[model samples]
Target: MTAISDRPQMLPEQFEEFARHLGRTVEGIRLEFINGKLGIKPVPDGDHGRIIQWLNRICIQARPELYVHDQGLKIQGYRGGFARPDGTLADADAFVGRGDWATTEDVLMVAAVTSFDSETDRRDRVEKPRAYAEASIPVYLLIDRDSAEVVVHSQPDGVRYESVRILPFGKAVHLPEPVGISLDTEPLKNWVR
Candidate 1:
């Protein structure tokens, strides 16, 4: 059988049109454009949803003035890419009036809860981090269920994250400036695969 892949399936404009149409017709799939390639992100499992919930609660409690979920961003710096982060931390009105793909400006952080899929490694762990960093997003929180770890990528210098800190599921993850908050990841252990 031919190998299924996440290669450059289509050009950026075509991808955007396809993604928009799919968003209206499809029920649970999400599309991303990163590194000039197309990626399909399936609806997350229950545990994956729970992890996002867990982080959402902590973020709300720590920074009541900001919101941390339900946002998409334009990324890959000048590459014209788009992504719908599992959870996007930004000012309450950061995406107000912006259409489906909003600019990455003022985005404090983006979180990804690994789905149990073949592309989890490359999509969540590899491409996304680079894309978010290139877009100068302050932080990228990876809830890697497969590895049972939390990988924090921060301090982007417009290329890649200069600082990366990985911690087991049960430890606390300290997010740096712009996203000045601490995550009590003890609850993450129960949700990992």
Candidate 2:
């Protein structure tokens, strides 16, 4: 008589090899796995790139704890899920002994400069905010090129944030305690979208 086998037919580890293979071939597009689903983000436009650059410089200057990370951006989530924000601010100490990604534990905020495309706009304003909140990133700073405004979202609870503050170009918006950044908006006003 043939013996019955107890081992599972397909182990979970088998699938990631396929994903890794797919990831290697993609170019210019950003890929993420959020809550077990795939998310694709297009390359930022020229204006978006400038906005990200400005945010990086100003944030690092404002706080010693903040740094500009250009690549390999991710916030760790369950079951190998990761989300890549355009730019990010995390405690400088958090990078110790890690590779490939950054955890949300020490992430003070995530930054995104919205695209002119409608689908991209929704992804930035809606889907990303929820994902960031779920990862427990304390703040989300969104520069809406469409509206010529900056919005700060903080105090995440579940899939939503408790605080949503909007500031038009040339208006001062406090980044709140912990981050505690007081940004001068004059340059942002001068920024041409």
Candidate 3:
């Protein structure tokens, strides 16, 4: 008698491999596997890269209990996918690797600087916030270049988030966890434009 078998489960490592392959094979399609689904978006612009760099500098200077990670760092979700935030703050020791670092229990925060389009904003402000909350990341920051504002999301409830605070440009937003530090907006303002 023939026996039934379960489908092959894809782990985070395998999913990353698939993403790398697709990134090379696909044309003009920038895809990232996030929250067990493929998050496909167009490449970001100069403003996006600037914002990411600015935040990375600030985070590193702050020297929170967590290490500050810039580009090339990916955060794996609770399911089988992953998301590469513009900046991530996690335990320094957890992020040691040659190419990509594995998500660890100490990864407390993830931030995405949005500059693509309305759809990208929606994904960063709404969808990704929910995904990070579900992943149990203590904090999620969304920097909107169009609006020149930062949205800090905390207190995860199920798949959603609470304690939503919006900090407009020219104001300092204090992040919760690892260390209590405020982010200056002067640099972002100067470069965003």
Instruction: Report the error of model 3 at residue 58, Å.
Output: 1.9
Candidate 1 C-alpha lDDT tens digits along 30-57? 8888866777878888888888888878
Best by TM-score: 1
> Which pairs of residues clash in candidate 3, taking residues 3 or more apart in a chain or in different chains?
none
lDDT of 2 by residue, 1-193 (tens): 5333433233223334434566688767766655455666777777678777787778878886678564344544443456667877776656667654556677777887776665666578877887788777788888776777889999988668899999987888788766788766667665555
Write the number of the candidate with greater TM-score, choosing between 2 and 3. 2
Looking at candidate 1, the ten consecutive residues that score lowest on lDDT are: 1-10
Candidate 1: lDDT of 166?
92
Which of the numbered candidates is closest to the native, going by highest lDDT? Answer: 1
lDDT of 2 at 93: 57
lDDT of 3 by residue, 73-132 (tens): 345444645676767776665666635535535666787877656577557876688777
User: Would you list the C-alpha lDDT of every candidate in the order shown?
Assistant: 0.84, 0.70, 0.69
Q: Please give the range of 10 consecutive residues that has the lowest summed lDDT in model 2.
A: 6-15
Candidate order, TM-score descending? 1, 2, 3
Model 3 off-target regions past 4 Å? Answer: 1-14, 23-30, 64-66, 71-79, 98-101
Model 2: CA > 4 A from native: 1-23, 71-80, 190-192
